[model samples]
Target: MGRIPGRLPFFLETFAQSSIKSHGSRIHPERFNSTSNKVPDMKAHQTREVIFSGIQPTGVPHIGNYVGALQNWIRLQELKKEGKKEMDLYYSIVGLHAITLPRDPLQLKKERFEMMCVLLAIGLDPAHCCLFNQDQVPAHSEMAWILNCIAPVGRLNRMTTWKSQIASSKNSNSLSEVDDSMLHLGLLAYPVLQSADILLYKSTQVPVGEDQIQHLELTKVLAKALNKQTKNKNLFPLPQGIYTRQSKILNLRNPTMKMSKSNPSDLTKILITDTPEEIRKKIKSAVTDSIESIRYDPENRPGISNLIDIYQSISGQELEQVQRRFQDKSVVDLKSELIELLIEHFRPFNAEFSRLVNSREDVEKIYLAGSQKAAAVANLTLSQVKKHIGLD
Candidate 1:
């Protein structure tokens, strides 16, 4: 069973100060309100753009994951390198969230390390941005326990992820078949935990796909709820969702569904580490109509359209441009070109990924260092939250 709900841990008091000073916590200094003894409006006053996002550690991510989110993360880092000096990025391998459902113990450890490697290989520089495992920081769960007190069950029930998960777990598509007695508390309330993850970092910008926008909305709601209890009403920044055109990538085997690891058939998705031969085989097997032509018609020709989407997302070309370029090419031609593109792109990155994964000692140290950076900022926020919630 999980730890008792609603009680913030006492360990944070001992840990917060050291972490803050060591990790470069940049919380803006605020003048105290002499009359009310409360912080001033911080909503309009955050000094830095705290950007946060996370990925589940399921091993090497597929091509869809890269195109959908990881690619955008690199873009964000590059933009910051170009001198967005005030922006800070935090990317976590959400191990804790991944285990909400059952997982093999040994595989979890392996996947956690591999996921970290994937981030590094994809150009998420730990020297600049914070990269760590969510489970490494105690304060995330501590803050989550605090958030749970005010989060509404109705809101959680409304979350489509939660709804679908509960349904799938019971092997039933109907809501009536879902038995409340068997409801997993962690699975149901993980969104609240996610809110804690965002608010802990004072994240003002969150990179999210279309499916996750509602979860971010729930974060804003919980932040508002907490701020309402304080005189300032600005303890947390309402983070906005960042979306990319390539956020929703469909499967190769079935164009109707998003490319996901949960799909039993390996042909449905292409992993970043797959060999040239494997990439070629999967692309060739990708479902398409007998039109013998390529177009971006997602409505009637989802199969060919899905391939076009993948090409445009990877090549950074507009839909019209991609269509024009492929207007005369056959389906076989498109598949061949996409296969070569993927193979050439992943060759160097895959080497780096393998090296990082194999060098367990170095990777562990890097992971710990990133965790410390994240913890320093998180613990500082928890310190203030303690004062507001009477944990002090």
Candidate 2:
């Protein structure tokens, strides 16, 4: 994670106040209404750029997670730092999404807290951004049901994620393996819920990686389908994807695959909280070719390229810049420098993690406050959806 440059005190205070008001029980429902509200109209234009994105809180985030998503989030915060009220941003800890896969309850709870702490430590000013867990907002699931009613079953069947998950399963020996009957409703309808997540906030721009482009397209499809069904115009604004070209940071031991928490090998991913010694060992043992001369050819030299990408992402330098700096350098030299950079980057985050992990009460309060804030906005959207669909 890069340093947050400088602290903008005025913007931070304003953000905190907004979060307080938005999360407070005293805010009138009419305040969010478009007709008479003095607050800047969040929905006046067809292309409102309110941003929303999330990550499953199954485990601590690695360098790849930070570069791929969280870094973009922090940059959005910097835009808010200018006191521009035009954009409403949100970043969530999707605990509900994490449960799609089986997990230990206690460990999951702890991981969620740690993930929140990491986000905060990484300069996600909650005051500037809506930071909360997905389950905290009941309307996410509520609107999901409403959208599910309007969504075509045929569309759900066509989702690539659902098909990919089923295809990858090892239990394909039985007839039930290929059947939709065995697919859980949550798994099948997760994309609908994802659409709900975006529409609930009326988000107009979603910062998404390559993996989620299909899901975002589905969200737009569902939004349009619902509007047509209800005979209402502009019911949900189709969100544009803010695609980032950040290099894909690959696993240390396996240069071909991404660094992920779910990998069976612990050495495959570098957790932000990994000690200095752990980082050094991982990088030192990172798979690299016997070839000399460090270069950025991802296909011909994936191992060294992965390291270079990691270095460039963290340092905010270009691939060419990194290559020039490390030109004529040995693989050992590249690995050694990467270890130092990573250790320094994670130092503050690790400190913040320790503090939050120790203070369970404070973490709980933040989540509780965030949930209330998120649910307030969510409920308003759900109410409109229900009334439009005759569920009221």
Root-mean-square deviation of every model: 11.2, 8.2
Give the range where candidate 1 is weakest over 10 consecutive residues by summed lDDT.
Answer: 27-36
lDDT of 1 by residue, 93-124 (tens): 98888887777999999888888877877766
Return the top candidate by lDDT.
1
lDDT digits (tens) for residues 11-31 of candidate 2: 222332111111222222222
Worst 10 residues of 2 by lDDT: 16-25
Off by over 4 Å in 1: 1-46, 166-182
Count: clashes, candidate 2: 0
